[model samples]
Target: MIAYRNAIQLGDWIVTTDNSGGIGEKMDDLVAVPDQITARFATRVALLEQWAAGAEPVAVLLHNFSGNASWHRYCEGIRDVFDEIGITMPPISGSSETNMSLRQSAVAVTLMGKQKLESSESTGDWYTYGTPLVGEEVLTKESEIASLTVLDEARRTGLIQRLWPVGSSGVLAEWRAATGNPDCDAASPLDVTCSAGPATVVLLQIDKEKLPNAKRHFGTLLHALR
Candidate 1:
């Protein structure tokens, strides 16, 4: 029998299976792990050993939406254990687009310790960080819309925005809108432009005064643009 352990998020919430054999059926209330202590692969390995017993090694699939150094480190820890057990672990996969059937199984690990798909200042904005806007896999139109929605929410939460790159045709328009200083004709040297969508390039300019605060909201974006 392929017994499976619970799905764990980076911050330490565990989604265990209930007696109904249903996957991700939250049995007990969500338990909170201490802030200082994160989950260790050793604990995961022990749980897997007990669940699988003497049966053939089960395939442990780790799903992530965003690929970052921290996630890489966590996976490396898992790999170490799998190597010790002499089992060929299943390939790790990532997807920014969501599939209804795989909802509970897909684990999202963000540095912010929040599950919401907001842009991270530390990680930088997705586009600025040069991290693929979505996962590498080709997505359907619907999935693309969903992905955009995630960004939109982030923008609304003051976590992200589609800033115009400098030197673009719309620079004047964006500047006017952002700074509300249309009468001032100050030429900006950094004339970089970012394509907001097909046939639409926005002028990108950053206000130095807002840099520090913006960095706190979307460091990845600043990194990419900088």
Candidate 2:
């Protein structure tokens, strides 16, 4: 239920969306940050969901509530995420609310992608990539966040059985839910229930026998769940 929430199957396509609010350069926002950074992380979440599902993204829809002036900067942020995956920015179409003044900033990104095929099953262990980071911590701990480039390459090489992005539920929660092992008490160095904020962490199902190669492939980004 956790992994399946973001992206859904629609015949040959998968449509997914992700959102963020109150974390921008707005007067009443919970976390004060740039609009560009806000949109970038929000876009990254939706794109990662599509990518993890083996979908080739075709279009993007953005909803901007910050202000009319923030639209262009939001687009730039979205494009920045696309650049990280080494793909051309998809056509973006959305609206901006400029009629009234809003206290907090809000944004949502929806991605439409074609699912080429189903993913393979792994006969190995589950591991996490990146530490759970939320709000201001996400801005400061850039090195701990998972890499889209690395994930893209791993999916292409068939090195992972399944890829699950960690959201607000944290690593252990996602792992247990995805594996259907609700009672699993795996040793973890990370907080089991902290928010991952825009999916900075991802759960990778890799064959136990291939752990060596996975270590080489993921480098320092990989961490054990057990």
Candidate 3:
């Protein structure tokens, strides 16, 4: 199974989570990235997860594992997201890794919501909204991964047939999961293999006829499955 997914199917509703790791640890010697950014980071992923699951968010859960000392600070970040959206912060819960003097930091946020994604009767062609970036690239090109502005516009426009977030397994793995076709290989214009630790990019399934909608949102960044 793909390690990172937009959301998992569960009846009419769905569940999803998005988390950040070494970035926060690296950004904050105090524990995690400024909690507000952490909150946004988690919420952003959760939103994509919700869309991938084909639903809307209802509840939330967080695993604030970025060392114990700055737990409250981390939470403040999460709260900032909910407040900005004008939605009551869902009933929240989390854990802090205390007692262990871990040198690095990590954090996880989960969201639960409802909506049927789509019928599985037919799967569409695969495309990518953004190119893959990981490791040092994720750090160097921080703005690209951090913002979901493009994704939000695409989702709101309802331009694509389906959506999935690229994760640790990278684009190639996610494409296989979506199409269930092994032996799928070709020189790709996009880096199909990179761990998008926090789902920095999304997997888009759109037919060629609707390519314009995809293009309007993603511009030259769009990559088709070869």
The per-model lDDT (C-alpha) reads 0.30, 0.84, 0.67
Over the stretch 71-173, how does candidate 3's per-residue lDDT look in tens digits? 7766777677666555676777767777675555677878888774555543467777666766566556766662365665566666677778877888788
Question: How many clashes show up per model?
Answer: 17, 1, 2
- Evaluate model 2: give its TM-score: 0.93
Residue pairs clashing in model 2 are 124-208
Best by lDDT: 2
Indicate whether candidate 1 or candidate 3 has the larger TM-score: 3
What ranges in model 1 sit over 4 Å off? 1-50, 65-67, 96-226
Candidate 2, residues 1-226, lDDT tens digits: the string is 1235568878768888888888888889999988899889988888878877778889999899888988998999999999998989999998999897688999898889988766555477888888899988998999999988998888788787778889997887888877889998767777768899989999888887777888998988788888
lDDT of 3 at 30: 43
lDDT against true structure, model 3: 0.67
Q: TM-score of each candidate?
A: 0.23, 0.93, 0.76
Question: Which pairs of residues clash in candidate 3, taking residues 3 or more apart in a chain or in different chains?
Answer: 35-77, 36-77
The lDDT-based order of candidates, best leading, equals 2, 3, 1
Q: Which ten residues in a row have the lowest lDDT in candidate 2?
A: 1-10
